[model samples]
Target: MSTLRIYISNQCPSCATAIHRVHFVRRLRPEQSVELINLDHQDTVRPSYVFGTPTYCLGNQIIFLGNPSEGELLSKLDQPLSSVKQIT
Candidate 1:
């Protein structure tokens, strides 16, 4: 199964909105998995190439840089594994 990785910071309103949207999606799709990474509390170093807070990563590919529309997220979730290549 694919995971949705959400990168966030405490002070970002957009992050809160993104999280809310993710939870909304989760309620609709219980099987979907989500991982929230709080930049403020990270113990390890963050990748330098990461775009910004409220980023959404599907597998190794980033689907959104900031807040994503519900439809956009759902569409990505609906994509089959055959269509999305797994990145190393």
Candidate 2:
């Protein structure tokens, strides 16, 4: 199963909004697994490239750098896996 991993930080001003949007997306796409990783926690392990809050990752790729609009996010999520671009 494919998963959507959302990385967030407590100190980021936009983190709250990004989290809310993710939750909303979850409700709309039950088939897709959503994981929230809080970078503020010392034990959290993430890719070194994920340096910003509100980063969205699908599989091993970073899909979005910040908060994305609901329509845009849904469009990306709904696409066939082969069509989704790989961003390391």
Candidate 3:
């Protein structure tokens, strides 16, 4: 299984919504591992890795940007790697 990482900026309004959505989804599925990275305080040197706030990275590769719907997030997680190309 791939890991999910959400890159966020605390100061961003959209990031706040994205954060809530991600947590809600995580709470529904406790078995899934989801990590949040706050760009404002984290030592993130490569801004390119996180092109913008509220970006979702799966297994070190960016998969989604901005706020994603619950269905979309779940679909991506359920998909096999062979079906979709990883951004990395």
Clashes of each: 0, 0, 0
Candidate 3 residue-wise lDDT at 47: 49
Q: Rate the local accuracy (lDDT) of all candidates.
A: 0.78, 0.85, 0.78
Put down candidate 1 lDDT per residue, 21-57, tens digits, no spaces.
Answer: 7788789888988888888895945656565788787
Query: What tens digits encode model 2's per-residue C-alpha lDDT throughout 8-83?
Result: 9989998898888778987998888998899989999878879898998888777789998888888888887677
Q: Which candidate is the best by TM-score?
A: 2
Candidate number that wins on lDDT, 1 or 2? 2
Deviation (Å) of 22 in candidate 3:
2.4
Comparing 2 and 3 on TM-score, the stronger one: 2
Candidate 1 local Cα displacement, residue 54, angstroms: 0.9
What are the C-alpha RMSDs, in order, of all predicted structures?
2.3, 1.3, 1.9
Q: Please list the residue runs of candidate 1 whose C-alpha ends up more than 4 Å from where it truly belongs after superposition.
A: 81-88
Could you tell me how far off, in angstroms, the CA of residue 1 lies in candidate 3 after the best superposition?
1.6
Off by over 4 Å in 2: none
